[model samples]
Target: MKRANFIFICADQLRYDALSATGNRVAHTSNIDRIGARGATFHGHLTPNQICSPSRATMATGLYPRHHGLWRNGVALDERLPNLWQALSRAGYVTMGVGKLHFQPLLAAAEREMPESLAYWAKPGSERWRGPYFGFDAVELVMGEANESTRAGHYAAWLRRNHPEVVDLYEPEASPASRAEDLKEVWKSAVPPELHYTSWIADRAVDFIKHQSNRPEPFGLFVSFPDPHHPFAPPRPYCDLFRPERMPRPTIRAGELERMPAYLAEGDDPKKDPYIASGEQPREQGFLLRTDDISAQTLAIAIAHTHGMVQMIDDAVGRLLEALAGTGVLEDTYVLFTSDHGELLGDHGLLRKGPPPYRQLLQVPLVLCGPGIRPGTSLGALTSHIDLFATVASLLGLPAPATDGIDLKPLIEGRATAVRDFLFAEYHPRRDACLYNQSVITKDWRFTRYPNEPAWGELFDLSRDPWEHWNLFSESEFSSQAHRLNSILDQGLPPQPLIPNEVLGAY
Candidate 1:
């Protein structure tokens, strides 16, 4: 029963109220609030897909992107399903990943321009090509943002081998253009903060936990932090760490998009979308359709550069937990921290994320911490993100993974209180069919719908409108709780069977 030793990280788009132990009074994530003050903090987790490669292909195949087919964002994950990094590398562990594993499909790595050629690890004896790819035996890849245009992989070959004079500030014809007419919401990066890319993903995840600390198997790593998502760039002293008149601001109601769901109150039009009109603000348009054409001091300088990119990923999660307590493996390790969905910083008046399933884009920001967990616990039940692949295959005793996500380790060790009474999400529409949608939150309603406009939907009673600003889906006394949560999204999540890569051979 050795097991225990994972890492997980993940950041891109953050927003579970932008932390500070989830009470975020303008971001000061004391190292992600010390992992919820040392373990377990699900505050209703969610995010089965609110975009970003289909919620990171449902946390790498714990299914549900309609059975992990990646239903949107240039879809891809069908490299024969079964994932969680090849089931923790066939159980011997030691898997690895560095940053932004949007599990393939950032516009197919810019139509295979293979990130400005460093592909195949700069060839000529391809040094063991480092990766069993999706099941990631090893991978470093990084794409987009910080001088955009899919910012070349291997973090631009480790910024052309250790910051070759600011590796041409991440290219795009040697950067320099964003004069903020909304280049996706903000910008400033001239590449600093020790040559950014979130400091090369926390120095390659503290050099892969100092090269897998005395390796005798058991290791998992995943680090991945593509910033407080968007061109909201943050560098140098975390770009003036928060002070847009002391943060908060973005809620903006005013006829709340006429009670939402006219395909998100008729928003889409990032200049007639071609993926939001090809980067760096191509004649701006989707801050939920120009939230009355931006301004509250440009959404308070893009929420004060997204609270200085979440305090530069909470100071790279306090230097990867001080490199796992300086390689003593920080009490056998388990870590977790989350994000792969969330960002609308402007709430109902929107700023990012689409097809509004709101709750600031499907909640996100679970915590976790190590071994037997439970310290300072929080768990408001209703979890998701495919329950972190069945709570890391039930903390390594294995089995679980054919998918619809369940083992949240008995609801984070308090021996369960709730794992599901309702919490589902989906948005399968790559390139607008009005951004297709579906949702359900329950434990006080949140609804959503829109199967191609089922008379347009959304309900939100979230325990008396938790900032949803009222919709009541054409209320008539909440129409039998929106037809019993649309019949639990029409009896979904039950039919997972596909792990058969052949056997029984004596034919």
Candidate 2:
């Protein structure tokens, strides 16, 4: 068996049901679904964290957030950590990372600049800067999420240099009224599809694959798209693809938060909360949006816009597959698609991510297709984002470094039916910060506990309430079940961080 090329495509904030293959009736993801047709889709896959940096760090190092020490969004991932791309590079694979690789803080100050930060990339001669970053031999990065006005990275530079006329089209205030909808944070970008960041990322990856096809060594390409994350702005025709009327209403049960945890009962005002006001996340937008007060129309429009973004990403995925097929490496390359984390999408009357990790925020889509992978299979065996490093290393016949993840090779190849018995996920407000919460998800139950406030917790019977509308934490009838799950959580906890938490910037 020869070493195979790997094209790992990741999307930020893409939920489990975003793909048509994954039971999304509204989103047309034909290209992404093709991978599932050619391989398997892991329906039980869950992200280890709710934020970008921590979850992405888990993918890179195969270590949970607790073990990695990047407890929040703005913290930088330790470069010394043994990462997946570095392992591939060591095994003679040419490694390249394109688009949003949020391994570090994007809003870091100039004094403490990082490759992933806007401050570092905005400097002179930064255009010539590529990786050796977090194991990738080369990188073509795009900083920030959907908003392009403040974006920095190679993609932003390209937009400014070649497509100056369309730069203002990305700004919400400058966008023509007709081009955008009446709803806030939902718009049809006037920027052409070819020049959008989503397309730019695909274009770079396709070009790299075409060039690498002529080379001797197998290549590992990390093509990450920052879209479908937030702002819900899709380019041109994609933005008009979905209608609000056709979109599904959010799964919000009245008084859902009041029954669960006290902290979740009320939305946080960034101006009032000390942690959020001083935290790394941009204060202008507020840490988390309050969806409870928003009208149903707004929620529908948001979902519709989100579906449009998903469509654009699907088209981008189509282009990547075409590149692989055109280069004659389609059979020799493994194409894996996943997300850093998930968006709440108005689930439980919550908008955006943070606090009270629901299934909508924790479950992410995982699809794998390549040599030896079973085609058209959908496996429900529990899996984690941490499993990718070990699985990839096994596929390439390389010795994997010590990691918290287990190899999913047997499961994907149809040799086994299950990988792990349960999954664990966590979130922290800041580096070395308290008010942290952890959840243990078993086959039948999902239990979350906040270590800081031991009395406040969430417990749901996944087998009975898949949407998690009912919180069984304080219910005496389900106390025994909660106790069992709590024990599992205690036993399954990973080793504490050995390194001190380093503060880099506001997230």
TM-scores, one per candidate: 0.35, 0.94
Screening candidate 1 with a backbone cut-off below 3 angstroms (N, C-alpha, C), the clashing residue pairs are: 144-151, 183-281
- Candidate that scores best on TM-score: 2
- Please write out the lDDT profile of model 2 over residues 224-250, one tens digit for every residue: 988788777777687678888888887
N/CA/C clash count, model 1: 2
Model 2 scores a TM of 0.94
Mark the regions of model 1 whose C-alpha exceeds 4 Å error after superposition.
Answer: 1-4, 14-175, 181-185, 192-194, 217-231, 234-256, 260-290, 295-340, 345-349, 352-360, 363-390, 397-419, 424-472, 482-507
464-507: candidate 1 lDDT, tens digit per residue:
77758778788798899898888887787432222222211100
**Which residue pairs show backbone clashes in model 2?**
280-506, 280-507, 281-507
